[model samples]
Target: MELRLEKFTKRFGDTTVIKDMDLTVGSGEMIALLGPSGCGKSTTLFAVCGIHKMNGGTLHFGDRDVTTVPAQERSVGVVFQNYALYPHMTVEQNIGFPLKIQKLGKAAIRKEVERLSELVQIGELLDRRPAQLSGGQQQRVALARAMIRKPDVLLLDEPLANLDAKLRLEMRSEIRRIQRETGITAILVTHDQVEAMSMCDRIALMKDGKIVQLDTPEQMYSNPRSQFVAGFLGNPPISFLPATAGAEVVLANGQSIARPRDLQASGDLILGIRPEHFGPQHGEGLQGEVIFVEPQGREELIDVRLDGGGDIRSILSAGAPIRQGDRVNWGVATDSILAFAPNGVRV
Candidate 1:
């Protein structure tokens, strides 16, 4: 089902938490509400699932307005961070709990539970209780439970946050696969950038109770609309240097990084360079002294302090002979550079 939030606003007493937020989630497409804690991503999820009442605006599930729908009547399934399962109930019971509440026949409930268990690859564990399952297994049970009702929309609130690193990685792929197979319009609320980028078709990056950017993960990373969006999406994080734009884009240290043709605007600007964009340069380039080096199997993260001033980071092959305190010259990919105004707006 397609989900739409128009001018959705929420407030707690006097302070507003969600401010006239508008989002359209296409049918069968998964979207992520991604941002730091207290950024209102969770608030938006609660509002969508009918857990929280909206202070203003309208919400729709497809063409039907559900602004006042009760949580249990919304046809929305929620998988929480803690995988809220009944400790004493067996996996089969837990998975079919929704159906049991509706008083389905025992045989029918058992068949539906079996089908969902197999879909989530937890059929063998159906006889096991929640306490007997591993973190990943418990998660699977929660997913199966959420889907047994065949909800039109699924809300996952940091469903993988409790798992170990290995399990988190595994579950990421598993969730994406299950989402595709189920074809439910899903919304994931998470602070993990990797989770959002890897699983969701599109990301709604939220900040200050509003969406700062809503786009595909690839586009959100490659073509960020603001510095915060760019900085929030990268792994090692993009480096920023204060610079002035005139005849050339010159760093505070007086190193000319790019020409007029490389920039979209002039005057005071900030240059953003991804760590991988810095490469060995024999000629005109930024000269810096290595200040820190971290080895990561196949590559090294090198931090450099410009000769005159400022600092930046670079990702280089492990074989690179550079070391801490060593002076080096690195050239940035001019075309890939991102220019921004001091106010964080993209130039």
Candidate 2:
């Protein structure tokens, strides 16, 4: 089912947590509401699930206006971060609890429970209790419970946050697979950039009670509309250096880099570069002294202090014979350089 929120607003007391926002989630496409904590991602997810009332605007599930509908009637399934499994009940009972409440026949509930358990690959554990299962198993149970109803929408609230690193990775793929196989419209709320980028078709990067950028993970990373969007999406994060914009962009350290012809902005600007964009100098480029080095498997992260002032980080091959205190010349890929205004807007 397609979900739409028009001019959505949410407030608590005198403070507004979610401003007037509009969003449309396409049928069978999973979109992520991604942002730092306290950025209204959770608030938006709760509103979508009908847990919180919207202060203004309307919400729609397909063609039905569900703005004032109760959560139970919204036909949305929610999987929480903690799994929220019933410790006393066996897996079969837990999975069929919703059907039991709806007065489903015993034989029908048993058949449905078996089908969902196999779908989530927890069929062998049907007799086990939540306490007897691993975190990953418990998560699978939660997913099965949410899907037993075959809801119109699925809302995942950091469903893998409690799992170990290995389990989190495993579940990321599992959730994506299940979501695809089910073909249900879904929304994932997560602060983990990797989770959002890897699982969702598009990411709604939120900040300050509003969406900062809405785009596919690739576009959000490579063609960020603002400095914040660029800095937020990268692994090691993009480096920013204050510089003067003129015929040639002059770095704080007195080095002049040829400004891109498309950049006609004047006055103070910030140069943004990713760590991977810096490479060993072939001839002319920035000069600096290696200040720190850290090994990351096949790659090495190196921090360099510019000759005059300022500092930048670069990722290099672990085999590179560079060490702390060594003077090095590194060139940045011209096409990868991004110029932003002093106010953090891309130039």
Clashing pairs in model 2, backbone N/Cα/C closer than 3 A: none
Clash numbers, per candidate:
0, 0
Q: If scored against the real structure, what TM-score would every candidate get?
A: 0.98, 0.97
lDDT by residue for model 2 (16-129), tens: 998899899999999999999999999999999999999998999999999999998888889999989988999999999989988999999999999999889998999999
Where does candidate 2 stray beyond 4 Å? 281-284
The candidate scoring highest on TM-score is 1
Candidate 1 yields a Cα-based lDDT of 0.92
Candidate topping lDDT: 1
Query: Cα deviation of 260 in candidate 1 (Å)?
Result: 5.9
* Ten-residue stretch with the least lDDT total in model 2: 276-285
- Tell me each candidate's RMSD, in Å, in order: 1.2, 1.3
* Model 1 agreement with the true structure over 1-347: per-residue lDDT tens digits: 99999999999999999888999999999999999899999999999999999999999999889999898888899999999999989888899999999899999999999999989999899888999999999999999999999998999999999999999999999999999998999999999999999999999999999999999999999899999999999988999998998877789998887664657688898888889887684234899899999999898999999988988989888988988999888888878888899999998
